[model samples]
Target: MTARKRLFFMQLAGLILAFLVLEWLAGVFTARASLPYALSLLAYILPTLPLFGIIPLSLNYTNNNPDLPLSAHRMAPVRRYMVRMGVSMFFYVIILMASIVALDRFELSVQIKALLAVLTALPIGGIIWAVSRLIADPDVDEFERMIMTRSVMASAALTFFFAAIWGFLENFAEAPDFPLYLVVVVYFGLFGLVQPFVRRGFR
Candidate 1:
């Protein structure tokens, strides 16, 4: 495998390891009655930031596979997408951390708390903007666009299916309620998971 391919695989492994470690820490923090709010929030929030990196990485690897000869022209859209996502995710992490800290540290009014919540959700708009930009970008290869569309559809389907199952379980069996926000995470995960299968069909 080429260097990019090797780096991609290494990153993938590192991401999974980080996730497991973070999950364990979160569990430990949850079990402790005296854990700091900051630490507990970090345990929950930090795991999500790394996941955004995987999308652009996968896109780059797929378009510029070592075995495939890709031109600079072909690589531009991927590069652009990476930059957009990187910037968006960066702002998301910063804003989320600030919002969490502010909410925890200060005794704020209900209105302020609601405003903070709105501010925290604002960065998610960046994600939506990035995706919409990618779709509207004329520079992206037709093949890449098709792959992205299919992957998104598959991810959406899986997320909806999982949500339905969890909703029913919560209603009937007294299962733990699933956080609605985690649907985004589940969609992203399924996005990555379905890539290989989607590519196989085109191959």
Candidate 2:
């Protein structure tokens, strides 16, 4: 396979592995802790893993191809991809938010919320993958490829940095007391901030 494809596969595999690890750790914690709290914590933590996919999709859209720049007429495919991605993400956010709100109104079990979150994310992931495949130009040059690589690295670095900061705060403040949703907010915020960097690095 080509380097770019290889990078994409490797990054995807890494993400899957990370999610598995998180799931295992969460499972272990749940086994040891009170069931309700464990389920709630897992529900909040699990959604954040899929949020990482946004970085790759954003980088793909941003660094599509610089040399063979799209004509206004030829840009429709890219524009369509952007629109699809945007709409899918908006719906995903709305679903997640509504789920949280619903939890407030009803005695929605944490396991149910977690399952719904995962199911909702699957379609969003499909949309992102479809849009990326549709929009990415196969003729991307070496420099553009390098830019894409840097963007992915930058996104990973930023994700790690924010996660570390939150870990530190959680440790220092003894803030297991805080709502689980706050951690999800932090993850979403970091993912959003990193997208522009990914876009700018391509230019």
Candidate 3:
């Protein structure tokens, strides 16, 4: 494999391993066990570190791959998209951690809690904006734009389908409640998952 592809896979593997380790440790600890706040936060954040690396590596791998056949014209928009996404995700981590720590360590007023919630949601807006800018960029080639658009549509469709099914199940079948905010994460994941197939079909 090329170095970029290898790096992407290694990062992906690291994320999976970290997740498994974290889950195992969580299982080992009793519900009543009191861990240090910093320790707990570190555990919460560790798996995500691999994701930061994986994002750019995956983008670079895809963009530079001979098999993908993207035009040189499209590369700039893709790079811009990557930068915006990376910045957004970085701030997401920081804001989310701060909000979590604040909520845990201090009893804030309702207004402050509401503000924290808004702050937590803000980075997702940046992600959405990044996608929009890429889609709407004049320099983006039609093929690239079409692929992104189709991937987004597919992601949205799948997300809605899953949410509708899970919502009914939760109401009628005693399934666990799914946090609505996580739908954004699922949508983004599906967006990535659909891209290879879309590109292959176009090829």
Q: Which candidate is the best by lDDT?
A: 3
Please report the TM-score between candidate 3 and the true structure: 0.77
My TM-score estimates for the predictions, one after another, are: 0.74, 0.44, 0.77
Query: Which candidate, 1 or 2, has the higher lDDT?
Result: 1
Rank order by lDDT, top first?
3, 1, 2
Q: TM-score: which candidate is best? A: 3
Give the Cα-based TM-score of candidate 1 against the true structure.
0.74
Over the stretch 1-203, how does candidate 1's per-residue lDDT look in tens digits?
A: 77787888999888868867876776677567555767766666776666666776677677768665667886776677777887787787767766776676679999998887787777777776787688668877788788888998999999999999999999999999898877877988898899889989989
Tens digit per residue, CA lDDT, model 2, 91-196: 6755664565456546877799888778666656756474345526554444544555555456557766766776788899764545543554454455456666
Angstrom error at residue 183, model 1: 1.0
> In candidate 3, what are the lDDT values of residues 19-92, reduced to their tens digit?
66864565355235666767666655664665677566767677778767777776778788889999998889
Score each candidate by Cα lDDT. Answer: 0.78, 0.59, 0.82
lDDT of 3 at 86: 91
Candidate 2: where are CA atoms >4 Å away?
1-69, 72-77, 123-136, 139-145, 172-203
Evaluated at residue 104, the lDDT of candidate 2 is 52
